[model samples]
Target: MGEELKVIVFSLAHEQYGVEVEKVRTIERMQPLTRVPKTPAFVKGVINLRGVVVPVIDLRGRFGLPEADYTDNSRIIIVAVKDMEVGMIVDMANDVVDVDSDNIEQPPEIVGGIKAKYLRGLAKLQDDRLLVLLNLEEVLNKSEIVQLEQFGE
Candidate 1:
Protein backbone atom coordinates (compact mmCIF):
# COMPACT_ATOMS: atom_id res chain seq x y z
CA MET A 1 0.00 0.00 0.00
CA GLY A 2 1.22 3.50 -0.78
CA GLU A 3 1.75 6.10 1.89
CA GLU A 4 -1.01 8.59 2.52
CA LEU A 5 -1.03 12.23 3.54
CA LYS A 6 -3.99 13.44 5.57
CA VAL A 7 -4.91 16.86 4.34
CA ILE A 8 -7.49 19.49 5.12
CA VAL A 9 -9.10 20.49 1.85
CA PHE A 10 -10.39 24.00 1.30
CA SER A 11 -11.90 25.99 -1.56
CA LEU A 12 -10.53 29.19 -2.96
CA ALA A 13 -12.52 30.65 -5.80
CA HIS A 14 -13.51 27.45 -7.68
CA GLU A 15 -10.26 25.56 -7.14
CA GLN A 16 -9.62 23.22 -4.26
CA TYR A 17 -6.49 23.32 -2.10
CA GLY A 18 -5.07 21.20 0.69
CA VAL A 19 -2.65 21.46 3.56
CA GLU A 20 -1.28 18.75 5.79
CA VAL A 21 -3.57 17.97 8.69
CA GLU A 22 -0.68 17.75 11.11
CA LYS A 23 0.03 21.41 10.54
CA VAL A 24 -3.45 22.55 11.37
CA ARG A 25 -4.15 23.78 14.89
CA THR A 26 -7.88 24.29 14.57
CA ILE A 27 -10.67 25.39 12.23
CA GLU A 28 -12.70 28.41 13.23
CA ARG A 29 -15.69 30.36 11.93
CA MET A 30 -15.60 33.91 10.69
CA GLN A 31 -14.49 36.26 13.45
CA PRO A 32 -13.94 39.95 13.87
CA LEU A 33 -10.39 40.94 12.92
CA THR A 34 -8.31 43.91 14.05
CA ARG A 35 -6.70 45.27 10.91
CA VAL A 36 -2.97 45.94 11.00
CA PRO A 37 -1.38 48.72 8.98
CA LYS A 38 1.48 48.39 6.47
CA THR A 39 1.24 44.66 6.10
CA PRO A 40 0.76 42.61 2.94
CA ALA A 41 -2.74 42.65 1.49
CA PHE A 42 -3.01 38.95 2.20
CA VAL A 43 -2.30 39.66 5.83
CA LYS A 44 -5.91 40.53 6.59
CA GLY A 45 -5.22 41.27 10.24
CA VAL A 46 -5.27 39.60 13.64
CA ILE A 47 -7.88 37.79 15.68
CA ASN A 48 -8.05 36.98 19.36
CA LEU A 49 -8.38 33.29 20.11
CA ARG A 50 -8.96 32.62 23.79
CA GLY A 51 -7.07 35.82 24.52
CA VAL A 52 -4.16 34.74 22.32
CA VAL A 53 -3.65 37.15 19.46
CA VAL A 54 -3.15 35.39 16.13
CA PRO A 55 -2.37 36.86 12.76
CA VAL A 56 -4.96 36.20 10.07
CA ILE A 57 -4.21 36.08 6.38
CA ASP A 58 -6.33 35.91 3.27
CA LEU A 59 -5.22 33.00 1.08
CA ARG A 60 -7.01 34.46 -1.94
CA GLY A 61 -5.21 37.76 -1.78
CA ARG A 62 -1.96 35.95 -1.05
CA PHE A 63 -2.48 34.10 -4.32
CA GLY A 64 -3.23 37.35 -6.15
CA LEU A 65 -6.91 36.56 -6.63
CA PRO A 66 -9.55 39.23 -6.48
CA GLU A 67 -10.88 39.62 -2.97
CA ALA A 68 -14.36 38.38 -2.16
CA ASP A 69 -16.68 39.31 0.66
CA TYR A 70 -16.77 36.95 3.60
CA THR A 71 -19.95 34.91 3.66
CA ASP A 72 -21.52 32.19 5.73
CA ASN A 73 -19.24 29.63 4.10
CA SER A 74 -16.02 31.39 4.96
CA ARG A 75 -13.65 29.84 7.52
CA ILE A 76 -10.38 30.51 9.25
CA ILE A 77 -7.84 27.72 9.14
CA ILE A 78 -5.45 28.09 12.06
CA VAL A 79 -2.10 26.40 11.51
CA ALA A 80 1.26 26.34 13.19
CA VAL A 81 4.52 27.16 11.53
CA LYS A 82 7.75 26.91 13.46
CA ASP A 83 6.85 28.48 16.81
CA MET A 84 4.01 30.67 15.64
CA GLU A 85 0.34 30.07 15.01
CA VAL A 86 -1.24 31.75 11.99
CA GLY A 87 -4.75 31.86 10.63
CA MET A 88 -5.67 31.72 6.98
CA ILE A 89 -8.99 32.87 5.59
CA VAL A 90 -10.48 30.46 3.14
CA ASP A 91 -13.61 30.59 1.03
CA MET A 92 -14.68 27.24 2.49
CA ALA A 93 -13.03 24.55 4.49
CA ASN A 94 -14.19 21.39 2.80
CA ASP A 95 -12.90 18.02 3.95
CA VAL A 96 -10.19 16.03 5.67
CA VAL A 97 -9.21 13.52 3.00
CA ASP A 98 -6.30 11.23 2.47
CA VAL A 99 -4.26 11.67 -0.68
CA ASP A 100 -2.14 8.75 -1.67
CA SER A 101 1.55 9.52 -1.70
CA ASP A 102 2.05 7.84 -5.05
CA ASN A 103 -0.77 9.79 -6.61
CA ILE A 104 0.75 13.16 -5.78
CA GLU A 105 2.66 14.72 -8.63
CA GLN A 106 4.91 17.74 -8.59
CA PRO A 107 3.02 20.89 -9.44
CA PRO A 108 3.64 22.52 -12.81
CA GLU A 109 5.64 25.70 -13.28
CA ILE A 110 2.66 27.74 -12.20
CA VAL A 111 -0.68 26.61 -10.93
CA GLY A 112 -3.27 29.42 -11.19
CA GLY A 113 -0.59 32.08 -10.67
CA ILE A 114 0.61 30.58 -7.39
CA LYS A 115 4.31 29.83 -7.28
CA ALA A 116 5.22 26.17 -7.56
CA LYS A 117 7.47 26.39 -4.52
CA TYR A 118 4.44 27.03 -2.37
CA LEU A 119 2.90 23.73 -3.47
CA ARG A 120 3.83 20.34 -2.07
CA GLY A 121 2.25 18.38 -4.92
CA LEU A 122 -0.94 17.79 -6.89
CA ALA A 123 -3.32 14.98 -6.02
CA LYS A 124 -5.75 13.74 -8.61
CA LEU A 125 -8.62 12.26 -6.68
CA GLN A 126 -11.79 10.42 -7.58
CA ASP A 127 -14.44 11.99 -9.85
CA ASP A 128 -11.73 14.01 -11.58
CA ARG A 129 -11.12 16.10 -8.49
CA LEU A 130 -7.81 17.88 -8.42
CA LEU A 131 -6.33 18.96 -5.10
CA VAL A 132 -3.41 21.33 -4.93
CA LEU A 133 -1.33 20.56 -1.87
CA LEU A 134 0.17 23.64 -0.26
CA ASN A 135 3.55 23.79 1.45
CA LEU A 136 2.74 25.89 4.52
CA GLU A 137 6.26 27.03 5.20
CA GLU A 138 6.94 28.15 1.67
CA VAL A 139 3.60 29.93 1.57
CA LEU A 140 5.19 32.56 3.77
CA ASN A 141 8.85 33.26 3.33
CA LYS A 142 11.12 33.72 6.33
CA SER A 143 10.59 37.46 6.38
CA GLU A 144 6.84 37.05 6.26
CA ILE A 145 6.97 34.51 9.05
CA VAL A 146 8.97 36.87 11.20
CA GLN A 147 6.47 39.63 10.56
CA LEU A 148 3.59 37.36 11.53
CA GLU A 149 5.29 36.32 14.74
CA GLN A 150 5.82 39.91 15.71
CA PHE A 151 2.11 40.68 15.32
CA GLY A 152 1.36 38.81 18.50
CA GLU A 153 3.90 40.76 20.55
Candidate 2:
Protein backbone atom coordinates (compact mmCIF):
# COMPACT_ATOMS: atom_id res chain seq x y z
CA MET A 1 0.00 0.00 0.00
CA GLY A 2 1.14 3.55 -0.71
CA GLU A 3 0.23 6.88 0.77
CA GLU A 4 -3.48 7.57 1.04
CA LEU A 5 -4.80 10.71 -0.60
CA LYS A 6 -7.96 12.13 0.85
CA VAL A 7 -9.90 13.46 -2.12
CA ILE A 8 -13.02 15.57 -2.24
CA VAL A 9 -15.16 14.19 -5.00
CA PHE A 10 -17.69 16.21 -6.95
CA SER A 11 -19.79 15.52 -9.99
CA LEU A 12 -20.40 17.35 -13.27
CA ALA A 13 -22.72 16.05 -15.94
CA HIS A 14 -22.91 12.69 -14.19
CA GLU A 15 -19.12 12.16 -14.27
CA GLN A 16 -17.14 12.02 -11.09
CA TYR A 17 -14.22 14.42 -10.41
CA GLY A 18 -11.88 14.77 -7.49
CA VAL A 19 -9.62 17.39 -5.96
CA GLU A 20 -7.13 17.01 -3.19
CA VAL A 21 -8.66 17.82 0.18
CA GLU A 22 -5.85 20.10 1.28
CA LYS A 23 -6.61 22.57 -1.49
CA VAL A 24 -10.23 22.88 -0.47
CA ARG A 25 -11.24 25.62 1.93
CA THR A 26 -14.92 24.91 2.23
CA ILE A 27 -17.90 23.71 0.30
CA GLU A 28 -21.06 25.80 0.38
CA ARG A 29 -24.58 25.60 -0.91
CA MET A 30 -25.29 27.56 -4.06
CA GLN A 31 -25.56 31.23 -3.18
CA PRO A 32 -26.28 34.48 -4.95
CA LEU A 33 -23.31 35.63 -7.05
CA THR A 34 -22.29 39.10 -8.20
CA ARG A 35 -21.31 38.85 -11.83
CA VAL A 36 -18.15 40.49 -13.09
CA PRO A 37 -18.11 42.03 -16.51
CA LYS A 38 -15.53 41.20 -19.22
CA THR A 39 -14.41 37.99 -17.55
CA PRO A 40 -14.36 34.67 -19.32
CA ALA A 41 -17.67 32.83 -19.70
CA PHE A 42 -16.49 30.11 -17.36
CA VAL A 43 -15.83 32.76 -14.79
CA LYS A 44 -19.38 32.81 -13.47
CA GLY A 45 -18.49 35.65 -11.05
CA VAL A 46 -17.71 36.20 -7.42
CA ILE A 47 -19.49 35.41 -4.19
CA ASN A 48 -19.28 36.83 -0.71
CA LEU A 49 -18.08 33.91 1.36
CA ARG A 50 -18.16 35.00 4.96
CA GLY A 51 -16.35 38.37 4.80
CA VAL A 52 -14.14 37.51 1.85
CA VAL A 53 -15.03 37.83 -1.79
CA VAL A 54 -14.06 34.80 -3.87
CA PRO A 55 -14.15 34.41 -7.64
CA VAL A 56 -16.14 31.45 -8.97
CA ILE A 57 -15.94 29.43 -12.17
CA ASP A 58 -18.60 27.14 -13.50
CA LEU A 59 -16.99 23.73 -13.88
CA ARG A 60 -19.34 22.83 -16.69
CA GLY A 61 -18.71 26.07 -18.49
CA ARG A 62 -15.00 25.81 -17.88
CA PHE A 63 -15.07 22.46 -19.60
CA GLY A 64 -17.05 23.98 -22.48
CA LEU A 65 -20.13 21.97 -21.68
CA PRO A 66 -23.64 23.21 -22.29
CA GLU A 67 -25.05 25.31 -19.50
CA ALA A 68 -27.68 23.95 -17.16
CA ASP A 69 -29.90 25.37 -14.50
CA TYR A 70 -28.85 25.16 -10.89
CA THR A 71 -30.67 22.80 -8.58
CA ASP A 72 -30.86 21.75 -4.95
CA ASN A 73 -27.68 19.70 -5.27
CA SER A 74 -25.57 22.54 -6.64
CA ARG A 75 -22.56 23.64 -4.60
CA ILE A 76 -19.60 26.02 -4.56
CA ILE A 77 -16.27 24.38 -3.91
CA ILE A 78 -13.78 26.91 -2.57
CA VAL A 79 -10.24 25.98 -3.55
CA ALA A 80 -6.90 27.64 -2.90
CA VAL A 81 -4.07 27.75 -5.39
CA LYS A 82 -0.97 29.67 -4.46
CA ASP A 83 -2.32 32.81 -2.74
CA MET A 84 -5.74 33.05 -4.34
CA GLU A 85 -8.86 31.27 -3.28
CA VAL A 86 -11.55 30.75 -5.91
CA GLY A 87 -14.82 28.88 -5.94
CA MET A 88 -15.80 26.24 -8.45
CA ILE A 89 -19.51 25.76 -9.05
CA VAL A 90 -20.07 22.04 -9.31
CA ASP A 91 -23.27 20.19 -10.03
CA MET A 92 -22.92 18.27 -6.80
CA ALA A 93 -20.26 17.93 -4.12
CA ASN A 94 -21.21 14.88 -2.10
CA ASP A 95 -18.24 12.67 -1.26
CA VAL A 96 -14.78 12.44 0.23
CA VAL A 97 -12.87 9.27 -0.45
CA ASP A 98 -9.45 7.97 0.51
CA VAL A 99 -7.53 6.78 -2.50
CA ASP A 100 -4.25 4.98 -2.59
CA SER A 101 -1.59 7.00 -4.40
CA ASP A 102 -0.69 3.99 -6.49
CA ASN A 103 -4.17 3.87 -7.95
CA ILE A 104 -3.67 7.14 -9.81
CA GLU A 105 -2.48 7.09 -13.41
CA GLN A 106 -1.75 9.75 -16.00
CA PRO A 107 -4.81 11.19 -17.69
CA PRO A 108 -5.64 10.43 -21.25
CA GLU A 109 -5.93 13.12 -23.94
CA ILE A 110 -9.47 13.82 -22.81
CA VAL A 111 -11.88 12.68 -20.20
CA GLY A 112 -15.56 13.60 -20.16
CA GLY A 113 -14.80 16.28 -22.77
CA ILE A 114 -12.27 18.07 -20.56
CA LYS A 115 -8.73 18.36 -21.89
CA ALA A 116 -5.93 16.45 -20.23
CA LYS A 117 -4.07 19.66 -19.43
CA TYR A 118 -6.66 20.56 -16.83
CA LEU A 119 -6.55 17.14 -15.25
CA ARG A 120 -4.00 15.64 -12.91
CA GLY A 121 -4.83 12.00 -13.45
CA LEU A 122 -7.45 9.29 -13.25
CA ALA A 123 -7.97 7.43 -10.02
CA LYS A 124 -9.08 3.84 -10.38
CA LEU A 125 -11.54 3.30 -7.61
CA GLN A 126 -13.35 0.24 -6.37
CA ASP A 127 -16.41 -1.15 -8.18
CA ASP A 128 -14.93 -0.14 -11.55
CA ARG A 129 -15.56 3.56 -10.95
CA LEU A 130 -13.05 6.20 -12.11
CA LEU A 131 -12.49 9.63 -10.61
CA VAL A 132 -11.13 12.44 -12.74
CA LEU A 133 -8.62 14.39 -10.74
CA LEU A 134 -8.26 18.00 -11.75
CA ASN A 135 -5.00 19.88 -11.93
CA LEU A 136 -6.08 23.20 -10.39
CA GLU A 137 -3.02 25.08 -11.59
CA GLU A 138 -3.79 24.38 -15.23
CA VAL A 139 -7.52 24.75 -14.74
CA LEU A 140 -6.98 28.27 -13.40
CA ASN A 141 -3.68 29.40 -14.79
CA LYS A 142 -1.58 32.21 -13.36
CA SER A 143 -2.90 34.82 -15.75
CA GLU A 144 -6.48 33.88 -14.93
CA ILE A 145 -5.74 33.96 -11.23
CA VAL A 146 -4.32 37.45 -11.70
CA GLN A 147 -7.53 38.43 -13.41
CA LEU A 148 -9.58 37.06 -10.55
CA GLU A 149 -7.43 38.80 -7.95
CA GLN A 150 -8.39 42.14 -9.39
CA PHE A 151 -12.01 41.48 -8.52
CA GLY A 152 -11.13 40.91 -4.87
CA GLU A 153 -9.72 44.42 -4.58
Candidate 3:
Protein backbone atom coordinates (compact mmCIF):
# COMPACT_ATOMS: atom_id res chain seq x y z
CA MET A 1 0.00 0.00 0.00
CA GLY A 2 1.07 3.58 -0.65
CA GLU A 3 -0.07 7.05 0.19
CA GLU A 4 -3.55 7.86 -1.05
CA LEU A 5 -3.91 10.89 -3.26
CA LYS A 6 -7.21 12.71 -3.53
CA VAL A 7 -7.41 14.05 -7.06
CA ILE A 8 -9.63 16.63 -8.66
CA VAL A 9 -10.42 15.21 -12.07
CA PHE A 10 -11.29 17.37 -15.05
CA SER A 11 -11.69 16.93 -18.77
CA LEU A 12 -10.00 18.75 -21.63
CA ALA A 13 -10.82 17.80 -25.22
CA HIS A 14 -12.41 14.59 -23.93
CA GLU A 15 -9.24 13.51 -22.16
CA GLN A 16 -9.06 13.15 -18.41
CA TYR A 17 -6.56 15.03 -16.23
CA GLY A 18 -5.98 15.25 -12.52
CA VAL A 19 -4.59 17.75 -10.08
CA GLU A 20 -4.02 17.13 -6.42
CA VAL A 21 -7.05 18.06 -4.34
CA GLU A 22 -4.87 20.07 -2.00
CA LYS A 23 -3.90 22.35 -4.86
CA VAL A 24 -7.47 23.23 -5.79
CA ARG A 25 -9.17 26.14 -4.13
CA THR A 26 -12.51 26.11 -5.91
CA ILE A 27 -14.36 25.25 -9.10
CA GLU A 28 -16.44 27.94 -10.72
CA ARG A 29 -18.73 28.10 -13.71
CA MET A 30 -17.90 30.03 -16.84
CA GLN A 31 -17.91 33.76 -16.27
CA PRO A 32 -17.03 36.91 -18.17
CA LEU A 33 -13.30 37.68 -18.12
CA THR A 34 -11.48 41.00 -18.47
CA ARG A 35 -8.79 40.61 -21.11
CA VAL A 36 -5.24 41.76 -20.53
CA PRO A 37 -2.84 42.99 -23.17
CA LYS A 38 0.50 41.42 -24.25
CA THR A 39 -0.19 38.04 -22.64
CA PRO A 40 -0.21 34.82 -24.62
CA ALA A 41 -3.40 33.64 -26.31
CA PHE A 42 -3.76 30.85 -23.78
CA VAL A 43 -3.87 33.46 -21.05
CA LYS A 44 -7.60 34.12 -21.30
CA GLY A 45 -7.79 37.00 -18.84
CA VAL A 46 -8.62 37.85 -15.27
CA ILE A 47 -11.81 37.41 -13.30
CA ASN A 48 -13.06 39.10 -10.19
CA LEU A 49 -13.33 36.23 -7.75
CA ARG A 50 -14.82 37.47 -4.51
CA GLY A 51 -12.92 40.79 -4.62
CA VAL A 52 -9.75 39.12 -5.81
CA VAL A 53 -8.68 39.26 -9.43
CA VAL A 54 -7.52 35.84 -10.59
CA PRO A 55 -5.69 35.20 -13.85
CA VAL A 56 -7.14 32.47 -16.07
CA ILE A 57 -5.75 30.27 -18.80
CA ASP A 58 -7.43 27.98 -21.27
CA LEU A 59 -5.91 24.54 -20.90
CA ARG A 60 -6.94 23.60 -24.39
CA GLY A 61 -5.04 26.50 -25.84
CA ARG A 62 -2.18 25.84 -23.48
CA PHE A 63 -1.93 22.30 -24.79
CA GLY A 64 -2.13 23.50 -28.40
CA LEU A 65 -5.49 21.84 -28.94
CA PRO A 66 -8.14 23.38 -31.15
CA GLU A 67 -10.28 25.84 -29.30
CA ALA A 68 -13.86 24.82 -28.71
CA ASP A 69 -16.98 26.72 -27.77
CA TYR A 70 -17.66 26.93 -24.06
CA THR A 71 -20.78 25.19 -22.95
CA ASP A 72 -22.76 24.78 -19.76
CA ASN A 73 -20.26 22.17 -18.66
CA SER A 74 -17.33 24.55 -18.87
CA ARG A 75 -15.62 25.26 -15.54
CA ILE A 76 -12.78 27.30 -14.11
CA ILE A 77 -10.64 25.33 -11.72
CA ILE A 78 -8.81 27.63 -9.32
CA VAL A 79 -5.52 26.01 -8.42
CA ALA A 80 -2.63 27.23 -6.33
CA VAL A 81 1.00 26.44 -6.89
CA LYS A 82 3.30 27.94 -4.27
CA ASP A 83 2.04 31.48 -3.66
CA MET A 84 0.38 31.80 -7.06
CA GLU A 85 -3.27 31.05 -7.71
CA VAL A 86 -4.70 30.85 -11.25
CA GLY A 87 -7.86 29.57 -12.84
CA MET A 88 -7.63 26.89 -15.50
CA ILE A 89 -10.50 26.68 -17.95
CA VAL A 90 -11.52 23.18 -18.82
CA ASP A 91 -14.29 21.50 -20.76
CA MET A 92 -15.74 20.10 -17.55
CA ALA A 93 -14.74 19.37 -14.00
CA ASN A 94 -16.96 16.76 -12.41
CA ASP A 95 -15.04 14.19 -10.37
CA VAL A 96 -13.01 13.67 -7.26
CA VAL A 97 -11.34 10.34 -6.77
CA ASP A 98 -8.78 8.83 -4.45
CA VAL A 99 -5.86 7.15 -6.12
CA ASP A 100 -2.92 5.26 -4.72
CA SER A 101 0.41 6.93 -5.26
CA ASP A 102 1.90 3.59 -6.20
CA ASN A 103 -0.39 3.38 -9.22
CA ILE A 104 1.19 6.37 -10.87
CA GLU A 105 3.73 5.68 -13.56
CA GLN A 106 6.07 7.85 -15.55
CA PRO A 107 4.41 9.67 -18.39
CA PRO A 108 5.23 8.96 -21.99
CA GLU A 109 6.77 11.49 -24.34
CA ILE A 110 3.36 12.91 -25.16
CA VAL A 111 -0.19 12.18 -24.28
CA GLY A 112 -3.13 13.44 -26.32
CA GLY A 113 -1.10 16.27 -27.87
CA ILE A 114 0.23 17.64 -24.57
CA LYS A 115 3.99 17.60 -24.04
CA ALA A 116 5.59 15.48 -21.35
CA LYS A 117 7.12 18.50 -19.68
CA TYR A 118 3.69 19.56 -18.58
CA LEU A 119 2.84 16.18 -17.07
CA ARG A 120 3.77 14.67 -13.76
CA GLY A 121 2.84 11.09 -14.57
CA LEU A 122 -0.02 8.81 -15.56
CA ALA A 123 -2.10 7.06 -12.93
CA LYS A 124 -3.58 3.74 -13.83
CA LEU A 125 -6.90 3.45 -12.19
CA GLN A 126 -9.30 0.57 -11.91
CA ASP A 127 -11.14 -0.58 -15.06
CA ASP A 128 -7.97 0.04 -17.03
CA ARG A 129 -8.48 3.79 -17.15
CA LEU A 130 -5.60 6.23 -17.05
CA LEU A 131 -5.60 9.67 -15.50
CA VAL A 132 -3.12 12.26 -16.66
CA LEU A 133 -1.54 14.04 -13.73
CA LEU A 134 -0.50 17.59 -14.47
CA ASN A 135 2.72 19.11 -13.19
CA LEU A 136 1.32 22.50 -12.19
CA GLU A 137 4.73 23.99 -11.49
CA GLU A 138 5.80 23.11 -14.99
CA VAL A 139 2.46 24.10 -16.47
CA LEU A 140 2.91 27.55 -15.02
CA ASN A 141 6.59 27.94 -15.54
CA LYS A 142 8.69 30.44 -13.64
CA SER A 143 8.21 33.16 -16.24
CA GLU A 144 4.47 32.66 -16.47
CA ILE A 145 4.23 32.46 -12.69
CA VAL A 146 5.88 35.88 -12.52
CA GLN A 147 3.48 37.16 -15.16
CA LEU A 148 0.48 35.83 -13.26
CA GLU A 149 1.78 37.28 -10.03
CA GLN A 150 1.88 40.69 -11.66
CA PHE A 151 -1.82 40.39 -12.45
CA GLY A 152 -2.51 40.01 -8.75
CA GLU A 153 -0.75 43.26 -7.88
Candidate 4:
Protein backbone atom coordinates (compact mmCIF):
# COMPACT_ATOMS: atom_id res chain seq x y z
CA MET A 1 0.00 0.00 0.00
CA GLY A 2 1.05 3.60 -0.54
CA GLU A 3 1.90 5.97 2.26
CA GLU A 4 -1.03 7.09 4.32
CA LEU A 5 -2.40 10.59 3.88
CA LYS A 6 -2.29 12.60 7.04
CA VAL A 7 -5.35 14.73 7.64
CA ILE A 8 -6.62 17.17 10.18
CA VAL A 9 -10.00 15.86 11.22
CA PHE A 10 -12.80 17.78 12.89
CA SER A 11 -16.36 17.42 14.11
CA LEU A 12 -19.51 19.15 12.96
CA ALA A 13 -22.83 18.35 14.52
CA HIS A 14 -22.33 14.67 15.39
CA GLU A 15 -20.28 13.67 12.36
CA GLN A 16 -16.51 13.62 11.90
CA TYR A 17 -14.74 15.16 8.96
CA GLY A 18 -11.23 15.86 7.68
CA VAL A 19 -9.11 17.82 5.28
CA GLU A 20 -5.59 17.23 4.13
CA VAL A 21 -3.13 18.58 6.69
CA GLU A 22 -1.20 20.37 3.96
CA LYS A 23 -4.24 22.50 3.17
CA VAL A 24 -4.65 23.69 6.75
CA ARG A 25 -2.72 26.78 7.74
CA THR A 26 -3.77 26.93 11.37
CA ILE A 27 -6.61 26.38 13.82
CA GLU A 28 -7.92 29.11 16.05
CA ARG A 29 -10.64 29.68 18.59
CA MET A 30 -13.81 31.45 17.49
CA GLN A 31 -13.18 35.19 17.55
CA PRO A 32 -15.34 38.25 17.26
CA LEU A 33 -16.52 38.64 13.68
CA THR A 34 -17.63 41.67 11.65
CA ARG A 35 -20.84 40.98 9.75
CA VAL A 36 -21.03 41.45 6.00
CA PRO A 37 -24.35 42.29 4.37
CA LYS A 38 -25.94 40.87 1.19
CA THR A 39 -23.80 37.76 1.19
CA PRO A 40 -24.88 34.15 1.56
CA ALA A 41 -26.14 33.25 5.00
CA PHE A 42 -23.29 30.77 5.32
CA VAL A 43 -20.79 33.55 4.99
CA LYS A 44 -20.82 34.51 8.66
CA GLY A 45 -18.58 37.57 8.37
CA VAL A 46 -14.99 38.69 8.39
CA ILE A 47 -12.23 38.96 10.94
CA ASN A 48 -9.06 41.00 11.03
CA LEU A 49 -6.20 38.59 11.57
CA ARG A 50 -2.91 40.39 11.99
CA GLY A 51 -4.12 43.26 9.82
CA VAL A 52 -5.44 40.89 7.15
CA VAL A 53 -9.18 40.70 6.76
CA VAL A 54 -10.09 37.02 6.49
CA PRO A 55 -13.61 36.04 5.56
CA VAL A 56 -15.23 33.47 7.80
CA ILE A 57 -17.81 30.91 6.66
CA ASP A 58 -19.97 28.78 8.83
CA LEU A 59 -19.43 25.21 7.59
CA ARG A 60 -22.55 23.97 9.31
CA GLY A 61 -24.69 26.52 7.58
CA ARG A 62 -22.99 25.87 4.26
CA PHE A 63 -23.84 22.20 4.52
CA GLY A 64 -27.45 23.11 5.30
CA LEU A 65 -27.12 21.84 8.83
CA PRO A 66 -28.76 23.45 11.80
CA GLU A 67 -26.84 26.27 13.43
CA ALA A 68 -24.84 25.07 16.39
CA ASP A 69 -24.27 27.04 19.55
CA TYR A 70 -20.64 27.92 19.99
CA THR A 71 -18.98 26.01 22.77
CA ASP A 72 -15.46 25.92 24.16
CA ASN A 73 -14.65 23.44 21.39
CA SER A 74 -15.70 25.72 18.57
CA ARG A 75 -12.85 26.66 16.21
CA ILE A 76 -12.01 28.45 13.02
CA ILE A 77 -9.94 26.45 10.59
CA ILE A 78 -7.72 28.60 8.43
CA VAL A 79 -7.01 27.07 5.06
CA ALA A 80 -5.40 28.21 1.85
CA VAL A 81 -7.60 27.81 -1.22
CA LYS A 82 -5.56 28.64 -4.31
CA ASP A 83 -3.82 31.91 -3.34
CA MET A 84 -6.44 33.11 -0.91
CA GLU A 85 -6.58 32.26 2.75
CA VAL A 86 -10.02 31.74 4.30
CA GLY A 87 -11.34 30.81 7.69
CA MET A 88 -14.10 28.26 8.26
CA ILE A 89 -15.88 27.75 11.55
CA VAL A 90 -16.72 24.27 12.80
CA ASP A 91 -18.27 22.89 15.92
CA MET A 92 -14.89 21.50 17.04
CA ALA A 93 -11.42 20.80 15.71
CA ASN A 94 -10.00 17.35 16.20
CA ASP A 95 -6.45 16.03 15.84
CA VAL A 96 -4.31 15.06 12.90
CA VAL A 97 -4.89 11.51 11.74
CA ASP A 98 -3.33 9.15 9.23
CA VAL A 99 -5.41 7.09 6.81
CA ASP A 100 -4.24 4.73 4.14
CA SER A 101 -5.43 5.12 0.57
CA ASP A 102 -7.09 1.74 0.81
CA ASN A 103 -9.20 2.96 3.68
CA ILE A 104 -10.34 6.11 1.97
CA GLU A 105 -13.72 5.42 0.42
CA GLN A 106 -15.62 7.46 -2.11
CA PRO A 107 -18.15 9.84 -0.63
CA PRO A 108 -21.70 8.55 -0.51
CA GLU A 109 -24.48 10.33 -2.40
CA ILE A 110 -26.07 11.42 0.82
CA VAL A 111 -23.82 13.05 3.43
CA GLY A 112 -26.10 15.14 5.59
CA GLY A 113 -27.29 16.60 2.27
CA ILE A 114 -23.77 17.70 1.30
CA LYS A 115 -23.14 17.44 -2.42
CA ALA A 116 -20.69 14.78 -3.53
CA LYS A 117 -18.88 17.28 -5.67
CA TYR A 118 -17.69 19.09 -2.55
CA LEU A 119 -16.10 16.05 -0.96
CA ARG A 120 -12.72 14.44 -1.48
CA GLY A 121 -13.45 11.09 0.10
CA LEU A 122 -14.64 9.31 3.23
CA ALA A 123 -12.11 7.98 5.70
CA LYS A 124 -12.84 5.19 8.10
CA LEU A 125 -10.79 5.33 11.27
CA GLN A 126 -9.80 2.52 13.60
CA ASP A 127 -12.52 3.45 16.07
CA ASP A 128 -15.26 2.72 13.51
CA ARG A 129 -15.94 6.41 13.06
CA LEU A 130 -16.19 8.00 9.62
CA LEU A 131 -14.47 11.19 8.60
CA VAL A 132 -15.80 13.08 5.61
CA LEU A 133 -12.65 14.17 3.86
CA LEU A 134 -13.00 17.47 2.07
CA ASN A 135 -11.57 18.69 -1.20
CA LEU A 136 -10.51 22.17 -0.09
CA GLU A 137 -10.55 23.53 -3.60
CA GLU A 138 -14.00 22.16 -4.29
CA VAL A 139 -15.33 23.15 -0.88
CA LEU A 140 -14.11 26.72 -1.33
CA ASN A 141 -14.25 27.34 -5.01
CA LYS A 142 -12.70 30.26 -6.90
CA SER A 143 -16.04 31.92 -7.59
CA GLU A 144 -16.94 32.07 -3.92
CA ILE A 145 -13.53 33.49 -3.08
CA VAL A 146 -13.86 35.99 -5.86
CA GLN A 147 -17.24 37.04 -4.51
CA LEU A 148 -15.67 37.63 -1.12
CA GLU A 149 -12.96 39.74 -2.67
CA GLN A 150 -15.59 41.73 -4.52
CA PHE A 151 -17.40 42.37 -1.26
CA GLY A 152 -14.24 43.78 0.25
CA GLU A 153 -13.52 45.96 -2.76
Best by lDDT: 3
1-153 per-residue lDDT for model 4 (tens digits): 757999998998888899888888889999999999988899999988887888899999888899989899999999888778789999999899899888888988878788888898888888888889988887778778888886445
- Give the local distance difference test score of model 3: 0.94
> lDDT tens digits, residues 54-144, model 1?
9999999988888999999999999999878999999999999988898899999899888899898899887679999998888877899
User: Candidate 2 — what's its lDDT?
Assistant: 0.94
Q: Which residue runs does candidate 3 get wrong by more than 4 Å?
A: none
Per-candidate clashes come to 0, 0, 0, 0
**Count of backbone collisions within predicted model 4:** 0
- lDDT of candidate 3 over 21-94, digit per residue (tens): 99999999999999999999999999999999999999999999999999999999999998878999999996
lDDT of 1: 0.92
Superposition-based RMSD of candidate 4 using all C-alpha atoms, in angstroms: 1.3
Lowest lDDT 10-mer window, candidate 2?
A: 124-133
TM-score of each: 0.96, 0.97, 0.98, 0.94
What is the TM-score (0 to 1) of candidate 4? 0.94
Q: Name the runs in model 4 displaced over 4 angstroms.
A: 151-153
